[model samples]
Target: MRARPGALQVGSFRGVPIRVHVSLLVALPLLALSFGGALQQAAETADVPPGALSGHPWAWGLAVAVGLFLSVLLHEMAHTLYALRHGGEVHGITLMIVGGVSELAEVPKRPRDEAVMALVGPLTSLGLAAFLGALTWLVHGLGMFQVQFALFTLAMLNAVLGGFNLLPAFPMDGGRIVRAALTPRLGLLRATRVAAGLGRMFAVLFGVWGLVTLNPFTLVVAFFVLMGAEGESRQVRMKALLERVNVEALMTPRMVGVDLDLSMQDAHWALRHEHVSMLPVTSAGRPVGRVTWAAAQAVPEAQRGGYVVRDAMEDGVVADLREDGWAALRRMAEARVPMAAVVDEEGLLAGTLDWNDIQRGMARAEEAERQRSGPGWPRERTA
Candidate 1:
């Protein structure tokens, strides 16, 4: 059977579309409110005549909020462009409450490439700020008072956004710069450890100050930074350990199988008695589809005995054991496939390999390798 298309698609400008996390959707209104409040305060402080720009303060504030978000989009786009230029593919750009992220298919392999990719986003923001500042100054010289004021506000906002993003925290541009610099010399793991450690330190300090000052937003940001850094570090370690491993080593050779002609009763008994949730549907010794206990349960008891396994089974894509484990995993994740049938040289079902099994096997292999190289083990003689 043909493999299913992965969830991620090459979108406009070769970017992928990433569904914004539900949490981000929940936070959008709050972010808009904060930006609007900032604009309202700025306008009030400037003694701008009420109803001059918009009849209501909220209207003007919302405009500023929208403009700020546009600036953020530009910042994320800059990162995505640089990544693509350097042979990396971007999944998508997501604008979260904290800021935005340009999700890449893989991190840059070289430290120099990493540094360039990390630095581009902030630099783009800074350049925008500088250009707007220059335009504001020119407008002031030309005696365009209203234009000057609007440009000035935009310039200042962009500067603040750039500065905030550069605050040396993990998952931030500044933190990425630190990691990039250290990667070549200290290695990715050590570099991540150092960068993440610094990030946690900042997170703790921010968290404490937020609590003492009773600022819930600050607390939220601190917690977000802390968790992001921890998760990033763990993911890096996991990828490093599993690199270059293949699917064959991790799959189960003896998968539960059912003939297409078998009645739903046989499938149900196999599911319940054998404790196997999934069964490969076969006909003439070849896999045709897959049946799960959940599918079996969906049928009414009265009709269950009359149904054939083929009638209830769902056709699924299978993976070759010789394929790269990491690539297979990525495909599975993108396709939203729970499990893949592992096939051997002749395209016959060799076994089944799921995501959990691959992770567990890699962990065990790494552990074994570590023990073998530990003290008291004789090193193999080299020519």
Candidate 2:
């Protein structure tokens, strides 16, 4: 399944693409309710009468919600900015019901860099809380009733948010710091396993607590944390497994091709007569584009005689075998492109590689390892 609420590029900062998922729109109102409720409770506790607040209930709710989201945005931006300073690419920052997430294109290559990036977000939140707390204290000393109460509540909420994020759980800023600390000694995979395991444990605790207490918020948070940890772990494992692997190792070098000048009728005949599902549209031994069965099907029978292969073929990114295959694969996967053109050392079209080919190669590799181990090796069941 795709990530909920399709992603949209909002903007960029320092070359880092900022994206937000559509589901974030749903989260905003919930965040407003949560923060507004908290602020309302705090105001009551502080002996501030409800009517003294400047805005109506809905306006107050919206204000608190905006403040909370602003805090979250700052926290996530800290992570993104820190990563950029370290020469790592930040894909985007996403806000969800649980909290915010800053996606880094790759993990920090150095332990120090990782630690800095992980620590920056929480530190930023803490700094904001402190600043707000000072402002609240100053306003209280100056006998400003409404402003002091509002600032105090906002500061307290930020402190709580920062404290919660610093919990030693996977998918949290603190957990990332833990991973960074353990990376040198345990290696990245083992470090990730530890962090993810702890994260899952915390998620289970949240879930069980929610069930016992009948708190829907806790249950939702548990699910979010669980899924986030699992996803991160799976991504790390895939990247580790695919390291140094090239497209040439798995591509079908015997890819069939049709002349670009050929009519759709000719392409359709080839499709019917040949077993291949797609053909590389080439001209004079140079690669151009792809003509698939689906493309041919779209052409009317009568028009097929006049439609050239170029009219039906779609353009795609082509890569040489010597390039970083894992990077290329990651790009293809992210773009949702189904296939990649694999080229030889001389940059000539050598073959085509699809997602199936990659999976098949991985399967064969796993099977070969199993056979070499004489069936005594522990085999983990996979989904």
TM-score of each prediction: 0.79, 0.85
Residue-wise C-alpha lDDT for candidate 2, range 1-383, written one tens digit per residue: 12234777777667666666666677667666765666667677655666566666555676776677678888999998877776776666776677788877678788778888888888888888999988876776465667877787678768877887887778888788888888888777777788899899999999999999998788988998899789878777666556646677767784446788999999998878866677677776566877888999999899999899988898765767766556767666555567777767765678877777878866666566568767543233321
User: What are the Cα lDDT values of the candidates?
Assistant: 0.73, 0.75
- Choose the strongest candidate by lDDT: 2
Q: Model 1: clashing residue pairs? A: none
Residue 40 CA error for candidate 1 (Å)? Answer: 5.0
| Deviation in Å, model 2, residue 264 alpha carbon | 4.2
Once fitted onto the true fold, the runs of candidate 2 whose alpha carbons sit more than 4 angstroms away are 1-5, 37-39, 45-50, 141-146, 264-280, 291-301, 311-313, 322-325, 334-336, 369-383
Q: After TM-score superposition, what is the CA distance of residue 76 in candidate 1 from its true location, in Å? A: 1.8
Taking the tens digit of each residue's C-alpha lDDT, what string does model 1 give over 221-315? 89888987897787676666665577888777854478899999889988898687887777765677788999999988788889999889987
